[model samples]
Target chain A: MADWLSPAEWEAVRLSLRVAFWATLFTLPLGVFVAFALARWRFPGREALNILVHLPLIMPPVVTGYLLLLAFGARGPIGGFLDSAFGFTFAFRWTGAALASGVMAFPFMVRAVRLSIEAVDPRLEQAAATLGASRPWVFLTVTLPLILPGIIAGTVLAFAKGMGEFGATITFVSNIPGETRTIPLAIDLLLETPGGERAAARLAGLSILLAALALVLSEWVSRRVAARVGGR
Target chain B: MLEVSLRHAFAGFTLDAQFRAPPGVTVLFGRSGSGKTTIVNAVAGLLSPDEGRIASGDWVLLDTDRGVRLRPHRRRLGYIFQEGRLFPHLTVRQNLAYGTWFAPKGAPREDMGRVVEMLGIGPLLHRRPAALSGGEKQRVAIGRALLSAPRLILADEPLAALDEARKAEILPYFERLRDEVSVPILYVSHSASEVARLATTVVAIEGGRVIAQGPAAEVLGDPAILPAGAREAGAVLTARVAAHHDDGLTELDAGGIPLFLPRVALAPGSLLRVRIAAHDVILSRERPEGLSALNILPGRVQDVRPGDGPGAIVALDTAAGRVLARITRRSAEALGLRAGMDVHAVVKTVSVAAADIGTSGAG
Candidate 1:
């Protein structure tokens, strides 16, 4: 697969896959937590929490990246405190690209998962409780397994979205070749350079193929999980 | 014994009910929108009543005055829902074992082998709930609740979702549960036949209030307290199987009167509770000649409760404990049917359906 493209183009593809994988991996637990809270719980400021989670989806990707930079830049308070106290930094780093991608994809993941969680009948949970299961135990044994198909669908969708993320990644971490220039960034660079149309076309085709493959894989997995959980 | 007194008001509806149920199967008998499910939920701690106290013997589950309320998990009640509520992700075996996983340690647990045998779910244990029929799912649900070692079981129309064939398939298992298991059951249902067959104690509720409460026989026999215009109004009789004739007939002794019916499927000497519908019984001033009815009992009229319509319900003190005859007011007056009047209660042998007969192991 690498031999088919220029070294720079191959590097972009690898970096995109890595960033998307990490983003999905890191955000799954939090995504499930937020989704469950939104689907099942009621408390003060619940609407505010919902809006906050969805703000990135409604706002332009560049604005979300700028917001992330303002909060997590090297000179920013949180960024400075983290660098001084823990020797950690996210400014212009590959991790910052992943953070941007995760934020961009977070709402999509939460929406899919929350719909599935809401579809679960609460009467089953009540039945579990009356049979001596505690609230947490009920979630672990009953609610979790029932909502697993939706989680899988959500995670795969977020991963696919992360793979194609460009506006947020480029704005947050810039278009460095190895550090953060993912497939979309490489395509953008190839399109702008003089006499670069051929290379640009190849990279663009690769991105489309990869994205389509991710979508197909996600659909296959969700279908299988649904069949297993739905028992027919 | 379980004592429940609860009051909860919903939009356009209010529930204020109080009743004491004995250790046997206490049925919450009412119509749809009659707050039977709400009462069950409150007792299970699934819903909180505005002002109420629920206790199972000494254990106080909820007491609004004292500010004591137990969560559903801590209440140790087993609930069987109308749809069975089996976890779709799990196999039949896993669903049955779910409650056992949460059952407190060192408590007397129901043996898994016995439960599997009783519910006859051994074959389906390896299969998922989706593969089972409605009757099979309910049986598994009952098994799951039983293995929880619950203080009491709450069944909210467990068989209501099934067809007549499935209901017939599951009713005996419930009868077995009532006779064998020591745990009390609070069953909610709207079917008169179900109530007549299962309830040892019947608590009749209407419009969110308990209109009547007593032994099943007392509450079911009197048509005046029965649900208005209930066509299934009947009387329950305790009888022992006396003989099984070769011509496909079984003879039962109801308080020393030979009551013959088309063959019942129980061994001789086994106690049976038979529900005789009032419409099936006829009254005559004297011992009437055969005219096709097989059973005739000599009894005096106990009470004649006249209805607004042409019908009158006459309660009788017959050898079968208590029998009721729904006769027309004109016939009742023409025969001078009153308290202390001697009459022969005639019942057609074929009108006594096999579905109305229930066997009790305790008797």
Candidate 2:
């Protein structure tokens, strides 16, 4: 497989996996918290918060990416603060691609988790409270375990979206080879290059195989989680 | 003692009630939507009453005027919900241990081994709640609450979700808990039989107010106040197992009167409560012989309260304590049954089925 593919192609595949893994991992906790709050709590501005969380899903991927660039760019307030205070940067790097992908996939993750949270019986939580568990303890022991399958589904969906991200990654990180170019970006490059049809076909085939594997793995994992949670 | 006084106004209903439950199983008895559950919720700290105070033992759980409201967790009350509400994600062992894991330091804990054994849930330790039957789930829920080391246990219609057989299966465990466990229980139920079988104190709630409250015998003996129509009203008698005869009869000493019923499944020393429905008793001015009824107790009629119908309820102060007899006005007139009149209260042996009997304390 290494002999058939150019080193650049292998690097894109590796970078895509790394970016997707990090994007999914870093945003999972926030996704659960936001999803739980939206699903269970009632407060003013709840609908607005819900709309804001879903904005990236409804907007074009390029627009989300552009918004990310404007807010997290080198000179932007958040980016500048992080650069000066934490010696960290995200502009035009693989880290920037991960951020873009994570933002783009967040809505799908939150929606999945929120639905699961909503399905949970609040009476169980009340029972937990009566049994001397504080709110946080109840969440950790009961609520989290009950919603594990949904979280797994959400994480896998986000990872898959991150792996295939094109518009957001290109707009935010500019598709630099090895540094930021992922499988999709590599395929795009191959398709545009002169007499690159065979290479483009190979990359496209690989992308399909990878996406299918992710989906199958996600389904298997979800089944195991649902079984462990004793959910029907 | 558990004292609760709360006032909460819903859209179309207002719950304003107050009652004191002594150290024992205090049952909040009423019909559905009659504020039994509301009072239980208030006592459990699950609902914050608009204004009131709730105290269990020495702990002041809630007091609106003093701005002292303990959260449900901090209140340290074990609550068994109607549907069990066991955590589906956890095994029985884990669910039972959940409350103990979070119990505050120095909180008195019920021995887990004893609870599991008494509830007969040892084999289900490794099983998840989904695999358990309704009765098993409720047993686990009760065990979970017990292990919480709560100051009080609040059971809100714990048997309401179960079938008759399941209810029969779980009732003994609750009786054991009531008799053996040190924690006082605040149980809510609409079933008169459940109250008669389990309650030491009965608070009859109706339309958000306590219509009657006293010892189970005192509250249950009056037919007019029973939530169930007079037809279902009965007297709860606390009796001791006197002897089990070879002839398939178990004799119980109710006060000093020897009452015989179908064989009961308890040892000779055990205390039992038998519910004799008002309609099951027949009154005679003099002792009658050759009657098939196996039990006859001499008593003086204390009061005769007639209903709107042709039947009248006669309260008796017998050697077996207080008993009620439902007879027709014609019979009352023929026997001239009145206050302070001596009579014989006759009861058939088979009239009190196994379902109408429960152990008053641990055997």
Candidate 3:
């Protein structure tokens, strides 16, 4: 495999893996919280909140990137506030690429986790409460353990989506070597350059391998968690 | 001890109940949807009642009038749901220990070894609750409750989800808890037989209201209160095994009457409480001879109450406390069965099955 791919192809492969890792890591906790809220809570503007969480999936990838730019760009209101408060910037940076990837993958994560949370029996929480577990304890002990399979599945889905995220990442954070240039962006660049067919092919192969690995990991983790919880 | 007086209205039903029980097994007996579980939940601080006051011993769990309400975990009460409700991910030992994790540090810990032994769950300690049989799960659930060292245990139809064989398998453990454990228990059930076997006090509920509350014997024996009493009203008698005859019979000394039962393994001097259904009893003006029934006790009719249908229930005051006999109106009139009338009550020895006889302390 090393002989088949050039040095640039390998760098692209490494960059894609890093971007996917960071994207999934950044979104996991927020995804879980949003999934739980959507599954278990009823509040004002709940429907609207749900729609907003899922909007990235329905809208075109380029449109989602534009919206992210307006809200999260360095000069935008939220971006300006975050930049002033935390001295952090996302525009045209690797962090911006990760944010775009995460936004593109978020719907998949939330849907998977939410479905699992809904599948869990609420009676178990009530039982925990009767056994002297407070609300947080019950959630940590009962709810979290029961929905672990879903968490794993959602993570894998988000990670795979992040690895292949193209339109949003390219639109939000322009491709830059050793910065925001992920494998999909490299593949797009190679496809556009003359005599870059071999590099694009190698990048495509790496993407396929990573996607397969993610699928297998998801299945393995889900089964392990299911066994731990006595689920079939 | 528990004192609960509560009123709550749901969408279409209202629950109004008031009762007090001493330190023993007080059963909340009622049909489905009669709000028995609701009352227990209120006492456990799981549900907030619109108007109520609940006290276990000296601690006030809930007092709506004073705007006092304790959280469920803080109430120091153990609850056993119908389904056992053991944590699926935890082993039986872990599940049992889980209760103690939140219990007050200085509170007395009930003997864990004794509880495990009593419930016969020693072999299941390392296994998950899902791996155990229905009976074993319930036993573990009971042990978990006991290990918490609760001030009072509230069981909401703990046997309602089990089969008959499993029910029988777990009842003796409950009996042991009632007799040996110092903590009071509020047992919920709709089965008369379960109440007869387990309860020291019976609180009958119907249509979300408590209809009667008293000693198990009085509550079960009263013909006017229970529908079962009108058709099958009977008195529970406490008797000691006197002797066992070779011909598949055991003679018990129930007060002055020699109550004969089918062969049982109980040793002589062992105490038993027998429930003789009123329908199985026969009333005669004089002692009849050559009858198939083996139990013939001579007593005087204490009260003759007419039932709704075509029968009358005669309360008999024998030397063995009070016994109820349900006789047809025709037979009652023919025998001049009335209060203060002398009569002989005949009970078929075989009709009183072994299942109807429960062994308890020397009552």
Candidate 3 stretches greater than 4 Å from native: A1-4, B227-232
Candidate 2, residue B281: lDDT: 95
Candidate RMSDs in order? 2.0, 2.2, 2.0
**Deviation in Å, model 3, residue B38 alpha carbon:** 0.8
Per-residue lDDT tens digits for candidate 3, residues B1-363, read 678999999999999999998878899987788899999989887789899999865799898888889888788878888998888888899889888888888999887888888888889889987788888888998988888878889999999899888887888788788878888899998776777777789898988999999998888877667623465456788888999998989999989679899986789998878888888998888789988888998998878888778988888888876788888888988887788889999999999966567777526
Question: Model 1, range B58-92, lDDT digits (tens) per residue?
Answer: 89999999999999999988899999999998889
**Which numbered prediction scores highest in DockQ against the true structure?**
1
Go through the candidates in order and give each one's DockQ. Answer: 0.83, 0.66, 0.59
Q: In terms of TM-score, how similar is model 3 to the real structure? A: 0.95
Candidate 2 - CAPRI tier? medium
- Kindly give the stretch of ten consecutive residues in candidate 1 chain B with the minimal lDDT sum: B223-232
Interface Cα RMSD, each model: 1.0, 1.6, 1.9
Query: For candidate 3, what is the DockQ-based docking class?
Result: medium
Q: Which portions of model 2 miss their true places by more than 4 Å?
A: A74-88, B308-311, B328-337
Error of 3 at A125 (Å): 1.7
Better of 2 and 3 by DockQ: 2
Q: Give the per-residue Cα lDDT of candidate 1 at A28.
A: 88
